[model samples]
Each structure stands twice: as C-alpha cells, then as structure tokens.
Target chain A: MSWTMTRKALWDLRWTTFWYALGLALYTLLIAFVYPTFREQSAQFEEIVRNYPEALLRAFGIEPGQGLSSSFGAFMHAEAYGFVWPLVAAIFVIMSGAAAVAQEVERGTAELWLSVPESRPRLLAGKLVALLVGMLAVVGVSVLSLLVAAPLVDAELPADAAAQLGVVLLDFLIAVAGISVLFSSIFSERGKAAALAAAVVLAMYLAWVIAGLSERFEWLRYLSIFTAYRPREALEGSSVSWAGLLALLAIGLGSMLASLAIFRRRDILV
Target chain B: MDSLPIQVNGLTRFYGKTRGVDDLAFTVERGEIFGFLGPNGAGKTTTIRLLMGLIQPTRGSARIFGLDCWRDATAVKSHVGYVPGDARLYEAMTGAQFLDFLAGFRPGIDPARRRMLVERFDVDLSRTIKHLSKGNRQKLALVQAFMHDPPLLILDEPSSGLDPLMQRELLTFLREEQARGKTIFLSSHLLYEVEQVADRVGIIRDGRLVAVATIEELKRQRTRRMEVAFSMPIDLAQLASVDGVQVLQVREGGRWVELGVSDGLPVLLRRLSELPVVDLVYAPPDLDSVFMGYYQRQEAITGERAR
Candidate 1:
C-alpha cells in the first residue's frame, strides 16, 4: 500500500480514532473494576440473569444463567457483548466506511486526490489499510484495558474467554467494515451509503436476536452474520471454528475486494 | 516530435441513456492556454472530467502526452495539476495539512515552488479549510494545482470564487505558467474570463463543439453589424426580405435599428438606402456577439428539429 496516503488518512482521522478508543477503554476499565465484586456473588448474579425474561436472554445469546459466572471473561462477555460492542462497532465502522470513498466524491475532494500521481487502486488500498488499523486500535485498546484491569482486581480471566472475545470482535469488525466500504464505493453520497449499510447490519443483528427468541425462528440465525460466534460459546472457552464464521469472513473480505474493483472502474463524477 | 498536451477524438459520454457530451474533438498544443467555453450543463465539465480521467468516455478516448487518460491515468496525472469545478475539501484539515497531504503523493514537488505559490496567492495555511472564505479556498486550490509545476494544468472554473483582483492574479499566473512551457486547458462559461489570456478558444454547445478559433478570428468572422438611424419611423418589415440579414435590435421607437449581416451587405445597404436613414455605422462583431451568434444559430436548429 502507499504508506504516504495511508499516513495521511491516519493523521486526518487521528482525533476521531483517539476519542473513540479512549471511550471504549474507559468503559471496559469501569466494567472490569466492577467485575471483581461480581466474582464474590457470581451465583447470585446468575440467579438474577435467570429472573430476566426468557426472550431477552435468548436475544442477547446468553444461556439461562451460564454467562455471568465467576470467570472474568464470562462476566465481561455477559456485560458487554449482549448489546454494547455490536452497537458501538457498527456505528464506528459504518460511519468510517461510508465516509471512506463515497464522502470524498460527495465533498468534491475526489477530484484533487483522483488527479494526483497515484493510481485509483493504490489510493483505495491505502485508505482501506488505515481503516483496518484504526478499527484494530480501537478494539485493541478496549481488550487491553480488560486484560490490565483484571489483574488489578485480583481476578482471573480464562485464556479461552479472552481468545474467543478476540475472534468474535475481529470477525464482526471485519465483516461490517467490508460491507460498509462496498456500499461506499457504489454511492456518491455518504449519508445514503451509511444509512443503507447500517440498516443491513441492524437487520442482521435483529435477525440474530429474533432467531434466539424462538426455536421455530432458530433458522434465522443462518441469516445473521453473528451466527458464527456464539457469545455463550465464547464465554465457555470454545475454539472459533464455529459454524458460518468462514462465510462471514469470506463475505467481509469479498465485499472489500469487490469495493476495490468497483472503485478502480468508478467515474468519480464529482 | 512531441505529442500535443491533450487530444480527444470523438469523445462521448452518456449518463445511462442520456448523452452528456458527444463527438468532441480538440487539441491543446504545448505551451498555450486553450479556453474551453460553454454555458452551464453544456458539457464543458464533462469534457474536462474525461480529459482528467475522473470519468471515462463511453466511446473514444482522451489522451495526454500520448498516454490513454483512463488506462494510464497515473502516468498522465504525473503531468497534470487539476482544479475541480467544486472546491470542497476535507474541512477538518488546516490548509497546511491539506497541501502537505497532497504533496505526499507526488515525488519531488519543489518546496520553493509551493512556497512561491502560497505567497503569490496570499493564502493563510494556518487556518482550517472550513474557516477559509470562498475566495481563500479557491486560492488554496490554485496553490496546490500550480505548486507541482506539472507540464499540464486542467482547471475547470479555477476562478469561480475569486475576487476580481485575485482573478487578475490568476490570469497573470497562467501567463507565467505558459512562459514556463506549460499547456493549460482553462474551462469557463464566461467568455471575457479567458478572452484576455487564451491563445485560442473552443466553444461547446449542447455537447457539441460549435466553434474553435483564435479570439481575433472569432471576432473577425463573417458576422457584421450595422446601426442605422432613420430620419423618421419606417416600415422595418420590408428589410426582412434581404438575404443573410437578421434583426439584432430595434430601439428609439424603431427609428434606430441594428441589423446583423452574415452576408448580403450590398443588398442590405441598398435596402437601407431606400429607407429614411440619417446615418449608418458599420461595426465588426465583438467576441461576445460572435459567440452569441453560434449559440443562437444552434438554438434555432434545435428548435426547428424539436418542431
């Protein structure tokens, strides 16, 4: 990739990345500090989870009372994965992905960049690299804060819990970013592309949640991108070869490649 | 022998079924400023976009320095610095950051040249792009486009947001650039904007090139106008029978009249001689009228075809 262009994208987006990562880290640290207290009354917390509506528990991918156990990873997953990470990651990547290519054309800056000495593919590749790094940094800071705070509280996270969290988050972030970039490449307006990509992600999450609510609709889990990484499985210290994970990875990477091709041939039309 | 700075052969583009520009052919020689003139939506921008390879031609090709604009765009771009029709940039960037980022893509952009352009344009790089006035933003665009000192400059309405003084500065800059052996393609809807600096002019109308000539040649074309002052009001309809004369204007209760003659001067003069004419003044067509003649003729043909 053109490091010059990649550096430019990163520099321009430095503040955005910093503030978002800082927020994620602060939230993760707060939850981790509180997890030590939950460890003392882990069985009582599981009983509270059992008191929740059966439909809500399924929607969150939580078993009757399994996720909120004494393990630090399970506690973190029980608190964050249910709704927080998916929402935050979707907003971050969708906003960034939409702005990547489509917003440049919409703002008329594509003329300057497109006319520069770099080829279109190289330019796009640089932006995508920046996006990948930016997303990783944001998630990495959040995960690192958990790893750090767990020791401070004299609490232990199962190795499997940490590993599964990485797999699920990485898989989710890649697929969402790829889809968003694909939409960005197609539309000249970022708002339109962002809206549509966000809608698709929202639909997938809703389908996943809906699938968990009923045995009859369990088939809808196949329709959800999150079908691959079960939060319950992750808390239980399982490997990541979960069903459809590869397809999700393929869809994410495939969409990114498709975006590159589309942009290479697209008329900036600014 | 070197190829011309730019050459387009039968260039055309369609936004789906509707044609944007059609069958356009022109060449801008090296070290000359070629004015591309057209009204809004007349496809001037389309031609510029095609030449820049920001958009591909549906048929035909635009080449720069003998390189296919679409296929060898990177090579072609190394020779061009373009100012887009719209000057919107990343609002979050300070002007200095924007230029530095732009410079990062091209190797060996002379720091001296960039500094000179910034000073000449009087742009304040310390300010964020969003805070800059429309004119200052235009100046920023000019600075980046010229700083590279590329052999070719494709400027689409480069003076859009500039004040009159800055516009003059830009024209002077263009001259200096031409002297530096740069070939410039300046697109504008206003004729006078380029009339002062362009070595030649090309007028496009309804996606077609109607005229391509030097400014002097366009003014010195066959179209001529005569102002006649009648001693008193007379029947103006009788003059219509004269071939190759069109009524351009009638004033002062129809006693003072101006008629445009593409030919048939003798027949029109003989007819005018019969009227109660006190005086007549023969005038060569100005650049505006000369270009307007092309526009009106094209409009008439379009009207007729529509009918």
Candidate 2:
C-alpha cells in the first residue's frame, strides 16, 4: 500500500535498465568515433543538403549558417537523441510495461501475485511506475553521455540544452509507456504488444518527417507525436512549449487510465 | 443455509463460443476439506479461477465468506491462500525473494511459521525458482500458501509435483489446518488423494457438476465387489436373480462368482451362508471404480461417450 514499497518493487527491473544504459553508452562512442571521419572525407553532407534541401534540413534541424562540424554534431544528435535514443527508450519502456503484465500472465506469475492482498489497480500502478523509472534511467544515461561528449567536442555544457534534452526524453518516455499500457490491456502476448507499439512509434515518426518536408501537407503535423516535441528550439534558448507538453501528458495519462479501466473489467487469461 | 465459507451459484463463463464453466454451483462449509473431482478439461481450473476473481463470470456469481468475489477480491484474497494447478513462480527471483515478496503483501505473517513450513516441505530457499526442480518449486508454492495461515485455502492439484513423502506431509498439514477450523477447497484428478482428506467431493465432467456428496455417501452409492468360492456348485443364472447382486463373472465349474452389488449386501451374505462357502473375499470399492461409474453414467445421459 505504501508508495515507497511500490516504487521499490518497480525498481526491481534495474538490471534491465543497466543493460540498456550500457548499450546507449556504446552507441554514443560508435557515433563519436565513426561519424566525423565520414563527414571529413566525403561530400555526403553537401550532396544530401542540395538534393533534398528541405528534407535534409528538416531531418537534421540545422540553421542556415551552422558550420559542417557543428552541423555534423547536430546531425549526430538528431540521429541519436531525436530518433535512435528515443526509439531505444520507447522500446525499453514498452518492453518493461508489456513484460510487467503480459509476461506475468504468459508465465503464470500473475496468479501468484494476484493471490495476495494487492488490488489490481495498485499492482498495475506499481508496474507503470517501474516502467517510468526505466524510461527515466534511459534518459539519464543519454544526458550523461551528452555531457561527457560535449566537452570533448569543444561545446559548452549549457543548462538550457540539458533541460531541453531532459524534457524531450521524459516526454517521449511517457508517451511510449502510455501506449504500452494500452497495448498490454488489449493483448496478452508480450511480443505482440511490443511489436504493435514499435509500429505505432515508427508510423508517428514517419508522419512527422513527411509533414515537415511539404508545406502542402502541413496539417499532418497535428497528427504526429514528434511534431509537438521540439527539443532543438528549446536548446536554442526558447522557452519550453507548454501546449505541446500538456498535449503529450494528456494523451499519456488518458491512455493509462483507459488501460487500467479495461484491465479491471476484463478477464485475465492466466 | 449452513455457514458455508465458499458459496457459488449458477456461475458460468465463456471464451468466445466455448464454455469455460457452465452453471456451476456448490458450497464448502467452514473447516471442511472439500474436493473438486474432474478429468483433464472438466472446468475445474475455470471454477477455481472464477472463485479467485481472476476472471469475471459471464452469469451468476461466486462469494467467499459472504463477500462478492470480484468486487471484494482484495479483501477475500487477504484471508485466502491459493496454489494453482500449475504452480509457476517468478523465475527471475530467488525462492527466498519470492516468499518475501508474497509475505510483504499480508499484515500478520509469522516468521517462525514461514520457517517451519519451508523446513517441513524441505524446499531450498536460496536458489532461484528457474533453477529449482519441479518438485521443489511445488514445495515452494506450498510453503507460500500455508505460511500466511489464511482461513480459506483453494488448491488445484496441490500434490501434482510432490514426492510421496512430501505429499503425505502436505496432507497432514492440511488436516491440522482443518482441525483449526480452516476451510479448504481442493481440486484433483487423483481420487485417492481427495479421498484421503476431503469430507465432501464434487465431481465435474465436461464443464458440468455431475454429482456432489459426502465421501461416505458416494461410497455407499458405489457398486460393491464381492468374490466368493462355494463348496457346492452354484448356478450362475440363479445367482443373477439374487436381490441386490449383478453377476459380473462366473467360472466354468460355477464354484466362484464375482458380483457387483448396490445395497442389500446383507441379503447376498445370507444367500452365501446357505451354501458351504469355503472362502470369501469382500473388498470396498476403490476410487477408480467410483470415477469410472460416474463417467459411464454421465456418458449414457449425455450420449457423448468419447469425451
């Protein structure tokens, strides 16, 4: 019944979080060592910017006067923090949530847990909290990696950049956790839930990219989760967009509530 | 009208078009060790699940200690202990951790009781559940269920993976728990096991409650077997007319006969006394025969013998 007990129970998956963080660190190293060499040797950047100026610019989100080195770093950040890191974090959050319920049902562990005095809602809430902690840990690792590499790249560690990154990471994590909960409530299979969540995340990312490239289809931006999330603007000293933050939070919390409602009413298979 | 610890009335559940449990109703009075007897797919597990409030019943309702099972599941669970037919633990957790996790949920679990249960079951607490043998895992589950000392215990195949000695120990523990006025609702395919502990037995087949009665009543209703060797040759055809006996077998010499009798065993004995009965053997009905008779009767009534 205690929040602290539930929090500790949620933290039980720390080993999984540790591995994910380690993977993120290794990925950071690979990008730092390999990407700069590609930019120095080839006209890859110029060719990409020229052929599809809007597409390339939208992809990397660089300003007009930014130099190749900084643009390259921004490009790396776009790839890592924007898509790769968020994707990884989202997958982890979804996996954790899906595993929390569906895996227990699959392996018949839920029966044991349910046999106790814990209410269904409290058990579910505890799992959700655990998943949030996992997402937070992933975001923390991304921030740590950026901080470690920023000095090495001669870039000052700005407080605004840190805050922006933190918000983006947290927002993405919440969104994915919500989606995962919804999927878990509907599907008892862990693999199927994770796959469906991944598909949704990818579709949303693609929608955002397509929206940004064409003015004719600007309306599509409203449908994309990534559209409301703008980390770069925040990094450039702009205030965090409260409207976008509120929208994301609403969707996340709403989906989670729907999941709990359904879960309480539905029959558990295992 | 009795103070039944568990009461189910017209309970029904379905999965798509398939019926999981169909109009099941029964009761277990306080301090009674009741047995739910059934075959492989006879809705025994479904009934247990419904009682546990793990699933919603499509029709009617189940209650534990006069509280709605689904609505008051948390309250009921606190006072009830369950061991599923397939007792699977969190494979990632050590045996001790799983026990501790379960213990943390309840308010007043005695550490000494926990220690005593584990020791009695001979379960190793240090190893992860994944690494333990099936028997050990079952023992761990038993320890968990009994450690809290709840008033009502629902076990499905509680002896499935246990060794003979452990099974006996568990049965003894159940007896002691019953002595303390606890109620137990257990389901098992092993009729003998049920016979050892249960005061009342409910037989289910094809998702229907075929019969519910006391063990003595069931035994009384069962066909009694008697083998007799007479000094004088007895006519098999004449013995068939004996009041309560159905001749099952006859030897070529007509000196020995096996009869399946229902009631009037005293009349059969009187008839046997008229002849010089060199040797006679009367055996009480075993559990297997009782189950077979029930299934056969059910098959005839339903006209679907294959299942």
Best by TM-score: 1
TM-score of each: 0.88, 0.86
Per-residue lDDT of A4-109 in model 1, one digit per residue for the tens? 7799778866878888889888888888788878888878887888789977876666666464567766667767765676678678889998898999888888
Number of backbone clashes in candidate 1: 0
The Cα local distance difference test for each model comes to 0.83, 0.78
TM-score of chain A of each: 0.91, 0.84
Clashes of 2: 0
Candidate 1 lDDT score relative to the true structure: 0.83
Residue A149 in model 2: lDDT: 70
Candidate 2: global Cα-lDDT? 0.78
**After TM-score superposition, what is the CA distance of residue B199 in candidate 1 from its true location, in Å?**
2.1
Cα error, residue B178 of model 2, in Å, equals: 0.8
- Top-lDDT candidate index: 1
